[model samples]
Target: MDEIVRSNCTDRMRSYLESGCSLHYQNISNLRHLHSCERELEDYINEANAVLKKLQRLVEDAYDATLTANLSAVKVPDYSTADSKMNHEYHFTEEKQEQPADELDRDSSLVTVMILVHNMLKLDYTMQEKIVRSLSLKSSSAEIESYRLMWDLRPYVDGSVMDLAWKSCP
Candidate 1:
């Protein structure tokens, strides 16, 4: 992974830590705990959205750059004055386009996957937020336990994508 990508990933990790989005309160037995959980959820959702917006912009810029470069590389062979296209002789020389093009494609794909993973994380955060909001004093122990398990376990987060991101860590 490159420096920019590695540090962007670290930025995300820092965001998560700052927001405390990855925490779970298994036992919210009182009003104070409940309100704190609610506040934490709100903070988490806001922070997650901010991170997602930044990621989206980065992804969009990468994709747009790739598109612009690809468009410039594509050229139409002009044969307006030629009698027959097949009979016309053409000289083709591939001028060192492979390496840069391959790198652009890789970067584009990386940003795409990064956004996808971040969006997955955003959705997971939303789900946890909903669970937190639904909590009440009358809620059953089983339901609270289930919610805690879901929030802590994070079933919605794609492990493979996260693993790839972690591999980029410096």
Candidate 2:
């Protein structure tokens, strides 16, 4: 009876050790899973930051184009002539005509629109290149799709629309 009791206790101890080992293995697996999740989250954040930076650059480019358009539209009208009398008369009238407030506003608006269009053109090119480069870099499908949309809008952004706008306005 004493021997039998000793044998039973030994068997119980072996089973307990096996159960503890299995629990330890499970804990290790859980930790590995957590680590993998953290890595994936970090990757997502980095991708988001890259996209945001690209978008900010595009906005800045658009703003610059608008400023250029406005400046170009405000050029003084040239009235030079070979006739001395006509030149004097032209100068006299030119000096008297103060730019109307509405004219100034119109000029500003036109400039803004032209600039916006130019910016769009630049964005189209930039986006196209970015998309191609990203594809080469093995970027995900979502990023490629975003760039494709920008690429498709390029034609309208060309100066032709702005030219038409000016023709229609005047």
Mark the regions of model 2 whose C-alpha exceeds 4 Å error after superposition.
1-22, 78-170
How far residue 106's Cα lies from its native spot in candidate 1, in Å, is 1.3
lDDT of 1 by residue, 23-93 (tens): 33333345567688778877877887787788778777867877787787676556674445535443323
| Poorest lDDT segment (10 consecutive residues) of candidate 2 | 128-137
TM-scores for every candidate against the unseen true structure: 0.63, 0.37
Candidate 2, residues 72-168, lDDT tens digits: the string is: 5556555454354565577765555455445556655665665565456556555554554455335557876766676666553666666755674
Residue 113 CA error for candidate 2 (Å)? 14
Best by TM-score: 1
- State how far residue 25 of model 2 sits from its true place (Å): 1.3
For candidate 2, list the clashing residue pairs, or say none: 65-115, 66-115
lDDT of 1: 0.73
